[model samples]
Target: PAVPAPPVPAPSDREGGRDDDTRDKLKQASAALDRRDFDLAERLANAVINSASPPKQRAAARLIHGQVQCIARNDQEAAQIDLRGLEGFRAMKQRLLNVCRKHGILGR
Candidate 1:
């Protein structure tokens, strides 16, 4: 009798799945932001934004990234950099807000 092999684990079951990694990265970014490490926070938040997660997670990641960008803008010594960062935050906020509104998650 031929025995069937065991089925492989789904993509979500892999170690550090997409959602888990995204959430972990978001936490790391938040910690970096709290420490005033704007550069590291931006990197980590961007990682979460670029992760292969669902729309809700992506929106959350964008919000975090926008926050980091806002912090960076406040610390910017150059006016050009500050303006650019502000623009980036506005765009990210708008995009995430649209997503949240569509999903009915914008209002409590």
Candidate 2:
């Protein structure tokens, strides 16, 4: 009889789901922000930021979080978050910057 091949492993075994989980959280956060669900967006972005994700991923989360703050007119908080992830936001996503600028986080 021929030997059977090994079974394929499923994705997101929890132990190996750190990055994937955080990536999904970030996507959800962005979607929430797009939907103007600031509370949900902030919660999901905070989850990604507090996870053991790579620095780049965390930075992306910060960007979303900052946008939420800007939308809520929390300029100080948005500025602080922007400072934390300056390099990532330096890519100048016009819409994000515009939101910050409108809220005075990026200055007038």
Candidate 3:
């Protein structure tokens, strides 16, 4: 008998598609933020922010976006993004608010 080749994965299965990429980017963005690599975090988050990703991914990106802005002392922009994206993320909302409050921003 001849040896059989393994079947290739379809587009939907390849790297789990764009949603996965969005998710990966969001994870990388968050990690980069935690690592204090604000520039890379900003770039990753910006990619997800500008992409047509799901709301959750965008929300996560927005969280990162706000955090980076805060680190950069862009209080106004941070407040805007954090407050808007905090809708479905209760814990994150509070955390962001606390961080902003600590920095004397306090989103409107």
Highest TM-score: give the candidate number. 3
> By TM-score, how accurate is candidate 2?
0.73
Candidate 3, superposed: residue stretches over 4 Å from native: 1-15
Measured over all alpha carbons after superposition, the RMSD of each candidate to the real structure, in angstroms, is 9.8, 6.0, 7.0
Give the TM-score of each candidate. Answer: 0.53, 0.73, 0.74
> What range of 10 consecutive residues in model 1 has the weakest lDDT sum?
74-83
Span of ten consecutive residues with least summed lDDT in model 2: 86-95
Candidate 3 backbone clash number: 0
- lDDT scores in order: 0.59, 0.77, 0.79
In candidate 2, the residue pairs with backbone N, CA or C atoms under 3 Å apart (3 or more residues apart, or in different chains) clash, namely none
Q: Select the stronger candidate by TM-score from 1 and 3.
A: 3
lDDT of 1 by residue, 1-108 (tens): 999999997656664576788888878877887788978877886776566766655555556555544445532223223233334456655654454444443323
* Candidate topping lDDT: 3
Segments of candidate 1 deviating more than 4 angstroms: 1-12, 74-108
The runs of at least 3 residues in candidate 2 whose Cα sits more than 4 Å from the true structure, single-residue gaps closed, are: 1-12, 92-96
Model 3 gets an lDDT of: 0.79
Model 3 C-alpha lDDT per residue in residues 63-98, reported as the tens digit of each score: 788878776656676567666876988777777777
How does candidate 1 fare on TM-score?
A: 0.53
